[model samples]
Target: MRGPASLQGRLSLWLTLGAVLLWAVAAAWTAVHLRHEMDEVFDSALEEAGQRLLPLAVRDIIGREEDDSPDQGVATLREHDEYFTYVVRDAEGQVLLRSHRADLGVFPPFSGIGFADTATHRVYSDAALRGTITISVAEPLAHRWDVAREALIGLALPLTLIVPASLFGVWAAVRAAMAPIRRFRAGIEARGGGDLSPIPAEGLPSEFQPNARAVNLLLDRLRRALEAERSFTANSAHELRTPVAGALAQVQRLIVEAPDEDTRSRARQVEAALQRLARLSEKLMQLARAEGGRLQAETPVDIAPILRILVADMGRDAGGRLEVSLPDAAVIAPIDPDAFAILARNLIENAMRHGAQDATVRVSLSPDGVLRVVNAGPVVPPEQLARVSRPFERGATDAQGSGLGLAIVEAIATGTDGRLELTSPATGRADGFEAKFATNRIETK
Candidate 1:
């Protein structure tokens, strides 16, 4: 049979089996000892009966007025069960007297002296009157066997009761010992996302503490690695922005001062290249901030005002192509203002860049802090819709911009325990794209 699968079950089974085996050995030893002691006691009684009755039988035989037959049965005063019986024999080996229950066939020919065993009885013989008379006492061996059997049964019955109790005790002890392992498993399962805290190993057994320590060491290493990566990304982006902005300014000056139209055209191209570099650097910084999990605010802030300012700033150059809708009440949410502005700006910029020429871009904020941005464009393919939200995964759109916009929005939303939903062919539209940031970390007032 297959053994138990759990550690507790296996330990309990083995311990209980060991206990039962020990009990069985003890019971067997006790039975053997009891049998030897019983034999000694019964033999002593047989010898005593033969020695005491020898002299009495000699006197009775001498006092007889007439001679008896070869075998004479002695009379008894009462009818009762007899466990011990005796016979009196003369010098010629003829039985002169016998007890009422005594059988002549059971006693053997007069052996010299001391105890002897027959087929069904234990016989002890003794002589008196200088070997003229001898008496033999016999006891049934079946009686001794019956007593030993009863004593062994008494020793075996209690083990049947103790087996179950012993098994239960072993199970309880094993389960108690495994409690620390269970707690450690739960601690590991509860960690997710950015939770890199070390699991405590206090009270755990020595054998299991090494596993816990290994896990904690791995988590510490991962935490340091992530911190280093974010720091590098943010620092690199911040350093490049200043130089890129200065270059863009110098290129703009060159474009105006150029005497030839061809020179002006080349300077304009350089300006565009520098501007794109600056935008890419800015996106990298935002990505670093989102990944750092610093998007939460100490108190609720009115995100509606931030959205209004962002839309107004972007709408100036939109040439009447932007449309906005906002709830009359303030949309209070628990999110960093800078992060919210970054998230809002990415949605607006993505829509403006991808929407059809002169098509109106619609931006709406629900009272519950659901921000939706929809733009007129070719419906994104089923396979590409989900992929577009990842970094550098631009769809079939021919827009000129960095592809990190939607990825930054997703990271910020996720960090603050919010959700982002993207749809191709925006709700109730035939050909459009939509980005929905449902910031559930909000408390509208």
Candidate 2:
């Protein structure tokens, strides 16, 4: 069978069907019970009428024996023929008395017992007169049949009205019960994509409160996800713009000055700047993948060794302009090796680009499990300190660097359950960058 089109219609159909089935059962039971009771009432009344008529039958039987003829008794009984049958017989089995219509050949059957059937209630009775005489009474079943027919007719009209009335009541109740669900659906449809607020539960019934709350909770999560995506996009566009513009400017210079050797050397320098821009673009894509929840970094990693490798690589890349200071001890945390390398490389690379030339970059893992990357850079204003953590918002004196470097590091740290912090030097001389990871050791390392 085809299903109902909506919840309200389905619920209404089910309730009406159930009510009809129950009503059929109960109404059938009631009609049968009423017929049975009517039969009982009629049977009792017949028995009572038979009681009053019996003594008259016995007197006529006794009178006939004394008269030696039934002619006189028969004449007296001639007046009552509509509701009775009377016959009398002697001890010799010959007819002694009879009514005007009573035939000697036909007689009512008698069980000879003076009471009704113990199992059924068809009353029977016998009374003895003068030792040898007998009188009997019985109620015919035909009277009870007539009473049942009349009782059924009396109830037919009432049952007809009850069925339709009950069905309408059932439909009304089902509609009222499902009204809240309809309202909730309408509320959802009215909202546009940009409207991510939760559905209100005010004035709703208790049964629908949980449903509204659950839908609102799902909307709340979706809003957060959309907000994070918007942030990633805005930062990506801002960070990518400068490098693209710089590459365009260098290309224009190369076209104009290619014939001169001195101008060619300058073009080569511009080409190097273009290479740095390409690398920055690639790093931004990686950061987007990590932040957008597309990257899965579930693995055991030896973070200390990863950091040592990154420090060594950055030291080589920096030439003699940067020096590395490291702790003698090692520390570990669970992470993807590629992700850890990216994080360490970005943090150290950002420090080297921003700090003073020939400055010492301290790389240390505390015994209590804090990884620190401190470089001696110009102090950042307290008001501007928090802006550096966000993408595309670089500090003063760091104009040549891509703003995405710290943003990528922060994404990695957040994904791995670590914290990134930037602090001003105690004497306000240099800026210090620190990241702390929850500590562990790699079983394989």
Candidate 3:
């Protein structure tokens, strides 16, 4: 046979087999009980026959002592049918009377007290003679078999109808139980790759409730990932297109129009724009790589050395607005040097862009491992301070620059389990933003 394709069919088969086994046991027990009942009825009939013969035989014995009318009453009783064999033996072990008439010998020896009888079902006892009388009765083995067959028929006929009905019921129950899973599968298969939405949980079994919730959570994560990737692509394209388009326009103008020095100077301006774009692209890529968690080569970086290097590099751009307060001791912390450089560069550059030409920018490494950067300018408001660290966010004075610098610095700080604090120090005395890195992380080297 081809096996069941659905859970319904399988469940039906298992239930039917179980029911059949139970029915077989029930039939066996019923047959045994019926045989015992029939045997009891047959043994009762034999006991009654023994009781009737007992009284008459005792009367005949008493009459034989009065000189003998030939005991015709006993002879009359012997003319009956041979359904049962009976014998009466004297105390001396001689046969006195037998229902068989002829000498078939006394009925086989039987155990007795008064009227002790043994049947195939069990034994029965009642008073028979003054001394003792015994009766051993048993129906044929074939009769017991007939009783068992009749009992089996009575027990099995009802089960024949009930078993099939039970199988059908189980099959239906199994089908109903599996319906929810099938529906879930169908719903999932109907969706396309672009469709990322929560699955409905209603009408499902309790066990499958978790599955629905898990799928919804996965969909939420997938939606967020897709949004992030799309934003990244758009931002990359826009950032790249501005520089490429400007460079192309500059090259076109240079080729098509060979005018005077002013025209050539305009070309140089375009060239500068291209250079700025290139720098921005390179910085963006660096920020991406750092935030992508790919930089693993971390070593001890001295804050003193990084500050000195950044001051030297930005000095020409700084227009002499920079000041440094060096500690007598070198301060070092464990960090990826490139990431640390990026962090320092952004902070110094932000200060240079926003601070006035006469405004002083101070860099210092604290003994407790904090690197403090303070610049002289208008202090950022408390509410707007947090805005500066968000990507693409800029302060009012920072319109000319791409707003990624503070965000990149914050990323580096967070990666190192460090904090970047922003505060508006007192005007004239501390008139600008203060960015502090933790001092406890500082290492003396």
Using TM-score, give the best candidate's number.
1
CA displacement after TM-score superposition, residue 34 of candidate 3 (Å): 54
lDDT of 2: 0.62
- Over 1-445, each residue of candidate 2 has an lDDT whose tens digit, in order, gives 9968976667767776777677667767877988777656655654565556556666655554464664333555345523333444443445544555544343433446345442323544444454244333333455555566666666556657766776677668867876666677788875433456877667677888988999899888987887678567658856886867777676767857689888777777777777677667767776764465422246554456676777777777777655444445544456677877777777777777777666776666554446667777667777777788788778887347778888887776666556677776523343554433433343332
lDDT head-to-head 1 vs 2, winner: 1
Model 1 residue 316 distance off true place after TM-score fit, in angstroms:
2.3
Structural similarity to truth (TM-score) of each candidate: 0.60, 0.44, 0.44
Ranking by lDDT: 1, 3, 2
Which residue segments of model 3 deviate by more than 4 Å?
Answer: 1-258, 294-297, 426-430
Give a tens-digit lDDT track for model 3, residues 311-359: 7888877777778777777777776667777777788777777776577
> Residue 141 deviation, candidate 2, in Å?
3.3
Clashing pairs in 3: 368-439, 369-439, 369-442, 370-439
When 1 and 3 are scored with lDDT, the better candidate is 1
Judged by lDDT against the true structure, how good is candidate 1?
0.89
Q: Give me the candidate number with maximum lDDT.
A: 1
What tens-digit string does per-residue lDDT give for candidate 1 at 84-128? 899999888888888899988999988688888987999998898
User: What is the C-alpha local distance difference test score of each model?
Assistant: 0.89, 0.62, 0.66
Candidate 3 C-alpha RMSD relative to the actual structure? 17.3
RMSD value for candidate 1? 7.4
